[model samples]
Target chain A: MTVSLNDLVFVAMALVIVVAATGVVMLKNIVHSALSLILAFVGVAGIYFQLSAGFIGLVQIMVYAGAISVLIIFAIMLVMDKSVEKTNLFSPNIIRLLAGMGLTFLLFVTLGVSIWFTKFPVVPAEGPVDAVGMLANLFMGDYVIAFETAAILLLVAVIGAIILAKGAEDKQ
Target chain B: MEHLFINIADAFTGWLMNLGLSPWWADLALLVVQWICIVTIVTANITVLIWLERKVSGFFQERLGPNRLGPFGCFQTIADAIKLLTKEDIIPSAADKLVFRTAPIFFIIVSVMLYVVLPMGDGMQIVDLDVGLFFFISVGSLSTICLLMAGWGSNNKWSLIGAMRAVAQMISYEVPLALSLIGVVMIAGSLRLSNIVAAQGNIWFIVLQPIAFITYFIAATAELNRGPFDMPEAEQELTGGAYTEYTGMRWALFFLAEYTNLVAVSALMATVFLGGWQGPWLPSWLWIIVKTYVIMMVFFWLKWTFPRIRMDQLMSFSWKFLIPVSLANIFLTGAGIHFFKWMGW
Candidate 1:
């Protein structure tokens, strides 16, 4: 057996994602945590790239790392009180840590049970990577209804955002 | 003949094999060499772009631009680079050192990595991924996080405000930008840059979809944070905005990233709308350069012509006008394509 460059890259990317994700939760500063979250998001995008899913990888970067991270940072900046800056971030107490451990255990058990109960879907073996075409076909053809529903959901969100902005304007 | 660059590269890699290097080593070397070339080209182009923008701005204001250093101030940027190199990097006492140091590096990396999907000419891309346009756009989206990092890391209230405004502006304009390109993607039926270019052989996408072109240009300008939409760097209002605290070479990297992004966007406009590298007589790469410069000039003109709009007006215009217009353009394109097909043309 021989190791290939692809395997090496996949390992590196996976490690980066895991480490960065850990940093996200462990960091004291919210801003640093958000930045760590961006790194984690980028690593996940890299993993998608390694899977030859270029379109999904790019969308991941755009949505999660780009828009979501920026939104999170903006929200943090806007809502954070000044006094919070001076104080050290509160570490979780033992009871809270135990609670978190319990939740993680529950999630793991749920995932394992589901995996054991359900058979995996058969994935097609057509190996050529026409990711863009395949994704576009899926989106516009078989998943057209789901796609349109997503668009409507976004439209509703936009309208809701506008109303919220207008209400703030009236208050001013 | 069309595969001139590809042939030269194949010959070089083959030579590396003859020199007793393993295939993997040669391939790795080739990859490194290609990345270095790309980075060098981007850096060199940024220098030229900075000088050109200055000259263009000067011309707009009816004055002589930088005409002293090396033939119409061609070397002005190089001199500025050296000056920046010698300057001391100052981190504010209150700044988060980790984020502050990393922000500009991330910004520059994102700026340069945009070159990966760009097709220099036919058979001339570094890596011609199938989703080239999507990759281009998604990479462009990541720059907002860089701005956010820069803004927050500076630890200044004004910087945070600028960063917040930037995030809002970028994310808002992003919708219109993506929507504006849908008509082109629909007509071309491919997301790859080379395929998109090939599809425009008979007629450029700009001619076929003028509405989409207009919307794309406007949204891209906003995305670049150039003048008229430059709330992030509105000096009079925000006092240099998110970059207020950065000094020395660190500051210069951010500036470099800005111009690099400018060039990248202009190149995208050429590839998607104007026929990319598709002119007769001149080599294809040269044609791309000419087209890209032409588009860049228009961007510069827009920068000098329009005054910055109010922040609220900017966001409103993007959401209300540009997004709807782009959506309509897509609808019209689909209908028009069907009509043409029905007419047997």
Candidate 2:
């Protein structure tokens, strides 16, 4: 029944995640929303760090908070009109709102039930796990095919993007 | 000499424990003390570095640097710091108030966060995370957001353009930077900064992975936004770029953060390639400082010697040249590792 420092930190990080996520959804300024998304990403990374998944946490920060957030902001800057006071608009239709609320409620219920039913594994107290090494082994040994497939998929996407960009230049 | 700082830290922690503080509270106190020491060292070091940079640049240009304030103008930066602190803090009327206010604060915080993973000496890191190098890189990447925030929040064309250029340049160079380090990581078989340094006990990675060293240097230069690759904040073109809307202590914070990043990257370079903290005559900490300063001198030399490159040229240099070169270095490193293993050496 005693609240420890770890629990306090977890609560703080969870609050950050929830508040930032809310900001992402409710903010009228698209840029502010994007910034909120970054905060939420960082909070999630903090949770990963708290769970001792340092590799995953660092990857989360690097890929999500760092690169992806920048990309999102860049896109926002490219498309946004300077004259607009509020960029992000919500629909006023009651039917759409009702539908959205229903869907969100359903999702929450499903996720809550799954979490309640799931049995979590207890981590051993021996020492810190070599998460990075185990991940490397998983990728290279057991999941090599899946890993290589993801790599090839990324390469193909890059090539397709380049081709699309090059075609637009040719037309210009 | 090697354990001097460690012993002092232990003694301080013991004293706190003797005062009836719990182990956790005592450890937290020690961490706070380390944080204060790092901040003080960074500030003091930056004071000297700024003065040295001015003197070196003046030497390069065959002109006398500031020599009026103190002996050889050694106190010039302190004077400037006071002036900056005393100057009026101006926030643009049209600016995004929250983002503008938080940008420099976040930038400096991100810059200082990089020190956590830096192996200052033998067993001298703060936390010594297993993925130390990755932690440095990921935390370093967060600075791009600070710049973006500065640019977007300023609501100025020049600031926006400069920030865009900076983000593009940083993103492009980051790939090569990470790739170039893979050679060292492959050789060391670990991403921990201390472990990488330990692997270099016999020979420096610079001697082994020459291509990686070269590519890493080039990429790091671009990443740090130094001269020849400083597309962001191209003063003549963008007029201070992301810093255009900032004034007084706010602008000073950005300047301090940039110099802080310069030192951190230089120190990392020393650790990765130049055999960190390894020398005969001096203590490990002193050795790291010497190597970091030597690398920083090269940075200063390059900055003063070369004209700023065109933005297009900078992008192409990183994407077309450095990336390929770094990728080839990774290949070569893998081949060499396998070759060494096959030879049963």
Candidate 3:
């Protein structure tokens, strides 16, 4: 089969995601790694856009690339000492390396098995889809319990963090 | 008058197709042309905006402003731009080279990308995505990272402090900004900006969702890092904030990007609240420009009138005041929609 423009775009975005994900893992500088993470997030968003999941794509950019990456970088800056270099060290001891390799192999096998066993749905070629509407309905209707549970979980986390912070201030 | 730009674009694409190019190539060429046109318009508009700001600030302070350069100092911004171009580019020796250099470029790119979803006239937008409003908000959020880059890369205490302040302020205000727009989205029943504009054909959302409009205005000002909320680049406190180490054209890019954002946000405000591009006498495109400028004038007025707020005060204002108000507005909007439906109006 001849490579269509869509295939080319998919390949390009896939390459970006792979390269940026690798950079996030391998980059020596924490800030650079964070930036690479942002790139990877953006590439995932592009893939979502390609799949016509516009709402999910925008949310990915907003929550991941925009908010989460900034938060990561801010945490990095706040916690790291002035010595920017040598912040992210890769120590490859035998035990650590073996553990890491085992975890990686396990993850790979799990993902591979899941992909091999899963039956993918074939989407019909149709006019534009109302992704946002479908998502809203799913969240508010059938998955309302799960959605509310996640919201409540986040609220608890926020309150817990606030109380912890305020408790520290009181001690000071 | 309504279909002027659309017709021209169609003719241009047709011309490209007649040149033996495939449909895909022609469309790509059309996209490139649109991008070029957007950049040119943004730059030209910024030139005028800068001059207007100077003049308006002069009016505020009872001064003549830049009258010496050209007629009412219209050419002053142009001259200043040229000077900035000619000035020696300086990078701090200790700076992070890549991030420092890329920050302004990224900032400007993010700012210009905002224009894509803006319905400039009736049936006028670049792509008109289903999640147009969401696209705008999400893309606009990326600019925060650019400021952080500028600050981090500068390798200066002032720059780092400024960037930290900017990130904190932007993150906080972003909540209120997004929440305030939810009311309009609820009323219009769509996040598509063009649909929101269309819904306001009868009555402006400003009247219907006044609380949303006010909260949005406040949140947007904080987002834009303008006066009273400009904690990021408080010159007296942070010495130009994230931009302290930038010089020459590098500094100019940040300036241009800020104005670009100002214009984009003002246009969005016009679209969401003031019935975008809708007027009785004027053409749709001209009407949008008029409404955008009117909103921009209010921005300018607020900037010139208020003193810069303290960082803590700015943060508290967003978290304590604007966020709660916007959440209340959303509740009111939901209740109002149900009430109207129950009344059979």
Residue-wise lDDT of candidate 3 within A93-140, one digit each (tens)? 889978987998999999999999999998778635777888889999
Best by DockQ: 2
Which sequence of candidate numbers ranks them by TM-score, best first? 2, 3, 1
CA lDDT, candidate 2, residue A52:
83
**Mind giving the per-residue lDDT tens digits that candidate 1 earns over B55-146?**
99999999888999999999999999999999998999989788889989999999888888888887778887788888888899888988
TM-score of chain B of 1: 0.97
lDDT of each: 0.87, 0.90, 0.91
* Candidate 1 chain A, poorest ten consecutive residues by summed lDDT: A83-92
Ranked by lDDT from best down, the candidates are 3, 2, 1
Q: Rank the candidates by DockQ, best first.
A: 2, 3, 1
Where does model 1 exceed 4 Å of error?
Answer: A83-93, A109-128, A157-172, B1-4, B22-24
Stretches > 4 Å off in candidate 2: A82-84, A121-128, A165-172
